[model samples]
Target: MSNIIQRIEAFSQLGQFLSQFTTERISKKEQVLHNDLFFDAFKMQVERAQEFNGWFTLDNVLFSCEGWSKSLTNENLNKFIDSINIKKNTPKTIAIIMAGNIPLVGFHDFLSVLLMGNSVVVKQSSNDKHLLPILAKYLEYIEPSLKGQITFTEEKLENFDAVIATGSNNTARYFDYYFGKYPSIIRKNRNSIAILTGNETDDELNGLADDIFRYFGLGCRSVSKLFIPKGYNFDKLFNAVFKYKDIINNAKYANNYDYNKAVYLMSLFDLLENGFLMLKEDTSYASPIASLFYEYYDDSNSLKEKINSDKEKIQCVVGNGFIDNEIAFGQTQLPTLLDFADGVNTLEFLNNL
Candidate 1:
């Protein structure tokens, strides 16, 4: 098997390959490796993803690709790898059960297991099954030694040393029961929130809109709720996010908006809405599609205590300076490789295993 350096180069090459598919356009770049063998096939897979899953629109899939392209650079990969201590040991096959809520959501775990010189048997979410296998083929073509190291499966997983599973709260219970004997990391439902001080500039507010609306708020990093100061003007936020009004044109998103809106109206819930988005005052972190739940905070200290108490339910906190490790306005989705999900260090977990 190739050493860690070679593995890094393979992923960096994969990043270059992904650069061709972005939100702006999908044009082939000649400099990327194995383009003749993989480019068009990968493009077709992107379209197939959109056709198979209503949430996986072309723009959203491309955005995911674009994010990976940026993250897989040589500098970023090296930095991420250098942060961890890699022990030369016999390889273990790690079982991964992935969620399909957003495009390539499980790719991070897939990459992490491989980078640690471990084999992976992936059970992908049917909602997001198309893109990763083709990309895995690209990896094999770039580094033939990796061919047998990666495996995708629909059958029951076996012959693995450890497990990592992501799902909703209900499925998490099952994962805990079934994988209890192994060294495992089980992730359940969690949502992101933003803290607003009413002093944000228009650009900052626009960035916040990206944090909220990107991926149709399906990813765990997506901001689904807000904590704003008392008497904060809603008009400022509504005006800033108006540029994303075109999101309503997507049939699936529009359907969700209409349905959620009807339910809210029928329940006599007070809501503040623009044509595309609706905001309701609530305490929950996971808001339904097309609606953002917000809470009024009288003071920052109390809000901080509240968030700290519910840390397990929160993913990324979007704020300027409200708390330690707060993600700046719209940057939640652009997490670096070191930003482990659920605050569990995946690389460290794999290393310890």
Candidate 2:
């Protein structure tokens, strides 16, 4: 327990250190541990992260860090841990196969494993191989006990007692076949959606813009689809979301937009566009970059039933007074520590294992 408390303190300190870098800029503060050692190095890591992954823009990387900084507060950490019972004190090596779609996407799993007195062998996606390793180094420096507890490998996993793997639907099958012998949590592709009632305030629509535009709609929590009322006027939605038009300036995003738009044009699919984002009437939950799929619903109950039936494919529902436990608009990316992926209580899973 004393060791766990020390680990918590070390993570909190890391939060404080991460707070220095925001979407605005990266600034060093004096009280952060090993500032002289890690501050500049982390900045270089951020730059290299973008160079390595085209989706990892500086703004997105800093935004991810900022969210982590806020989530790693002592109060939040305690609250998250308090909900679970940690009885597995004997350390077991847990293998984590992470997704590369977003920055530090696997940190929550990593933290969960470490906080539960387990070792982690992380198999990071090649696209997101930069940030978390450095942060792990920082954690090891702050808490020397964590040095051997955490390991990264590019090769096939071995000698791990349990597994946490995240990937698309196809890779999930692979994970199931390979890691089925172990206690495991394998996640499949899931996307988020929004429900619009035509009565939403402009502020709410604008907030939805953040949910859609953040991370370029690559995250599972990003709003990739919308369920709007029949005959809804899209002018207001377009007007509100247009504030994020600057996103098209990104070369990668623009290329995707052009490619998807050309494909849609060739296929004769109807699309609504405002120069940056395109909206298509599609039934699929996952939308390509720079595009969102929307479906018109006749009533809320039927829509609710449909959503509930397809819950496995959905990550979150963002709306106003639409669904129970729905995420508020613009807040999908700012998940609290307790917001475990796939609604599986990660801490509890680790604790019981």
Q: In candidate 2, which residue ranges exceed 4 Å CA deviation?
A: none
Local distance difference test values of all predictions, in order:
0.94, 0.91
Q: After superposition, how far is residue 153 of candidate 2 from its true place, in Å?
A: 0.7
Q: Give the TM-score of candidate 1.
A: 0.98
Which pairs of residues have clashing backbones in candidate 1?
none
User: Which tens-of-lDDT digit does each residue in 210-326 have in candidate 1?
Assistant: 999999999999999999998899999999899899999989999999999999999999999998899999989999999999999998888999999999999999988779999
lDDT of 2 by residue, 54-135 (tens): 8899999999999999999888888878886678467889999999999999999998888888899999999998889889
Give the 10-residue window scoring lowest on summed lDDT in candidate 2. Answer: 83-92
lDDT of 2 at 172: 96
- Tell me the TM-score of model 2: 0.98
Candidate 1 steric clashes = 0
RMSD for each of the candidates? 0.9, 1.1
Q: For model 2, state the Cα shift of residue 35 in Å.
A: 0.7
